[model samples]
Target: MSQFAENVSKRLCSLDVFRGMTMFLLIAEAAGFHEHFSTVTEGTVFSGIALQLHHHPWNGLRFWDLIQPFFMFIVGVAMPFSLRKRLAAGNQKKVTLHILRRCALLFCFGGLIALCL
Candidate 1:
């Protein structure tokens, strides 16, 4: 392997797939796909799958319930790889500044969104 290839670690494709799947499911939920889909698929063979898309009632776990935790897991797994990549490309100070800037922007945007809602 080349020096650069050795320096930069391989990305986890499975994690990317999970992240994409989670985002797609979230977007579908936001667009009201799940409600319509469940209604349309009711009493059919796909009803069970459609129901799995919805959250479980209190005191139970469901596929939808895992989405948030899986998203967090993906982030947790990716962060160290991201930091390592940045550090390999530059120095600790630059990576730390980048992380700080990202956090600040995310917080500001989150607050703005909350205000809008």
Candidate 2:
């Protein structure tokens, strides 16, 4: 494969892995794993771990709170590589417009989902 293609592929693979890990943590929390641990092992090390897995009560941040930001960071890291690859392939205008539209759609949908939740 071409060098550009290989680099893009590697970058995308790493991004996918990061996203997958983030999603897994989210799903595990949604499944009440942390809550269960906290309830079953209160006043112990497991309780402390469970607390870290959960969000802060209010007006603060926890490790769990970093998940969304980490996902965004991973996306930001991948964006330049993706855009460069597309532009290198000679679809400059089309790729830029498509990226803009995709980002806008994601923003809107994400806001809507947040509101619904």
Candidate 3:
């Protein structure tokens, strides 16, 4: 293997790839790919697959609904690796502040979205 490939394999590269794929799906959905595809493919064999791109209405889960939780799972999984690297750098103060700032921003944005909804 190449040196770059060897170095990447030593880390959680698969997790990064999974995170990228998850983000790509989210971006595609945001760009209306799912809605447009579903409309165009309606009443065909592909319709069933397209249906999975939308959330189920009140009774159960759908594949689309899982994308968010899967993303969150990826973040949770990656956090420890991040913390380990930061801690190894010996800057606990900066690390703690960064974590706090991230949490605060997430909370603010989440609240704003809920309010908008």
Say which candidate scores most in lDDT: 1
Q: Give the TM-score of candidate 1.
A: 0.77
lDDT of 1 by residue, 42-102 (tens): 9999998898899767657778999989878998999988888899999999888999999
In candidate 2, position 83 carries an lDDT of 77
Model 2 regions lying over 4 Å from their true place = 1-9, 12-14, 107-117
- List the candidate 1 regions with Cα displacement exceeding 4 Å: 1-9, 55-59
lDDT of 3 by residue, 20-108 (tens): 88988888889999999999999999998898887668557778889979988998898898899989887899999988999999999
Query: By TM-score, how accurate is candidate 3?
Result: 0.75
- Whose TM-score is higher: candidate 1's or candidate 2's? 1
- Winner on TM-score between 1 and 3 is 1
User: What do the candidate models score in CA lDDT, each in turn?
Assistant: 0.90, 0.83, 0.88
Error of 1 at 5 (Å): 8.8
- Residue 51 in model 2: lDDT: 78
TM-score, candidate number 2: 0.72
For all candidates, the clash counts are: 0, 0, 0
* lDDT, candidate 2, at 66: 91
Off by over 4 Å in 3: 1-10, 108-117
